[model samples]
Target: MAVLCLMLLLLAGDLAAFMQPPVFHPNPPTEYRTPNCAQFRLPGCPRDLNPICGSDMATYANECTLCLKIWEDGHDIKIIRNEPC
Candidate 1:
């Protein structure tokens, strides 16, 4: 009877350990800037609908988008016209 009680106690302890919730470590938050038209020089530019021509002779969605593309690609682009080529 004592041996049976000891076995039951060990089984209960094992079951309790197995039923525990797992621990998780989440990734750290990254810093990101929200894009907009007003800040149309580089990093954060809006994806607007108005198309424009760049000095590099490339068409972009808009002035803001053009600036962003130019900034990314290192192109000498500027607002040639407020229309697509």
Candidate 2:
């Protein structure tokens, strides 16, 4: 009876551990900024709606807009993903 109780306790412990929610570690927060459009000569981007995500965590209207910002601001901005941020 004691051995059976010990086995049941062990099983219960395992079950409890399994039932616990998973823990996830997310990436560290990044510093983002809004580009100063007025301070620089803005390039005339096309009206096409090709969305893109930039390293600045902003959703540019398209890749041309992001490139224009990078060129005007002299910042090393890169494309984070192909989707809108």
Candidate 3:
């Protein structure tokens, strides 16, 4: 029937919308600033892994991608100041 076809079309549209991956761009208008946690300055570590730009309260899952960018660009990262939590 016409009603059944209309319902199926609406359901398909709604499902398609939800299937797309969600994008989280916090600062859309501003330039994307990658945090400088940099290399593991601390010595005597089993393995040297770059630090991520997240805090005790929250974690930025996107930081892993940012770290890779900094490493590839050969940017020297240093913790200039301790940010207040």
Candidate 4:
């Protein structure tokens, strides 16, 4: 009987620990540096509607459009996210 009680107590402790919520640690934000775009001279992009967010906090029509802008203005533009800003 004593051994059974001790086992139950240990099982209760294990259950308590398992019932607790898990802790989450998010990763730190990434730092992005602009690259030189002067050497890349790309052609015109297609007229698509797939929007994407840029590191410059602007919403681009698509990845091709973003590349076109980088080639045209010679600015270091990067895609921050796939969705619109």
TM-score between candidate 4 and the true structure: 0.51
Stronger candidate by lDDT (2 vs 4): 2
Worst 10-residue stretch by lDDT in candidate 3? 76-85
Ranking by lDDT: 2, 4, 1, 3
Error of 2 at 10 (Å): 35
* Candidate 4 Cα errors over 4 Å, as ranges: 1-41
Better of 2 and 3 by TM-score: 2
Tens digits of per-residue lDDT, candidate 2, 2-82, equal 999999999999999999998743543364434444453457767789787788778988777887978778987777666
Question: What CA root-mean-square deviation does each model show from the true structure?
Answer: 16.5, 9.8, 8.7, 11.2
lDDT of 2: 0.74
Model 1 Cα lDDT, one tens digit per residue, 1-85: 9999999999999999999998642532243223334565567656668887666657777777776775678755656566666
lDDT against the true structure, each candidate: 0.66, 0.74, 0.45, 0.73
Among these predictions, the greatest TM-score belongs to: 4
Query: How big is the positional error of residue 2 in model 3, measured in Å on the Cα after superposition?
Result: 0.4
What C-alpha lDDT, on a 0 to 100 scale, does residue 67 get in candidate 3?
46
Compose the digit string of candidate 4's lDDT tens values, residues 1-85.
Answer: 9999999999999999999998743632265434333434458566879897777788888777778877778777877667777
Which of 1 and 4 is ahead in TM-score? Answer: 4
**Clashing residue pairs in candidate 1, if any?**
none
